[model samples]
Target: MLFSETELQRVSVVIKGILTPYVAEKIDKNHYRVRTEIKRPGKYLADVFDSDNLIGKINLHVLSETQKKSGGDDFDSMF
Candidate 1:
């Protein structure tokens, strides 16, 4: 999937909004990827400032329709 400049910007905004409060720091970003350091809240960051904390990582991927539908390892051998 190809995203236009505007579309990518939109995606970035959405991702940033969701991630800013948890990330230790925002490393960098591009159209296809973003890298950052983050740790869990409260216990991990008692008194630290961070853009986003690390509860988990999120990856935005564009998958083909067929791949999305037949997606699984349970039938890998059968396939």
Candidate 2:
């Protein structure tokens, strides 16, 4: 089979033109972010979980008596 290089370039230009800048920017950022996770992996459910303990029994307490969280889980979710 034979193909024309000019036709390929035209299709490429059309595809690039239709993609919005915001969408394109997000895709670019996501591509690079994948690398960081591999370098220094953080907590993952699979890593913490095992056959014997899916959820730690210690976390099942009904109430929290801690001073920081007085009534019902008032835990600070600060980022």
lDDT of each: 0.33, 0.21
lDDT (10s digit) by residue, model 2, range 1-79: 1122222211111111223111111223112111111222232221111223222111111222353264445355532
lDDT of 1 at 18: 43
Off by over 4 Å in 2: 1-61, 67-75
Model 1 regions more than 4 Å off: 1-58
The alpha-carbon lDDT assigned to residue 23 of candidate 1 equals 23
| Candidate 1, poorest ten consecutive residues by summed lDDT | 41-50
TM-score of decoy 1: 0.22
Model 2, residue 57: C-alpha shift (Å): 23
Per model, state how many residue pairs clash: 6, 0
The candidate maximizing TM-score is 1
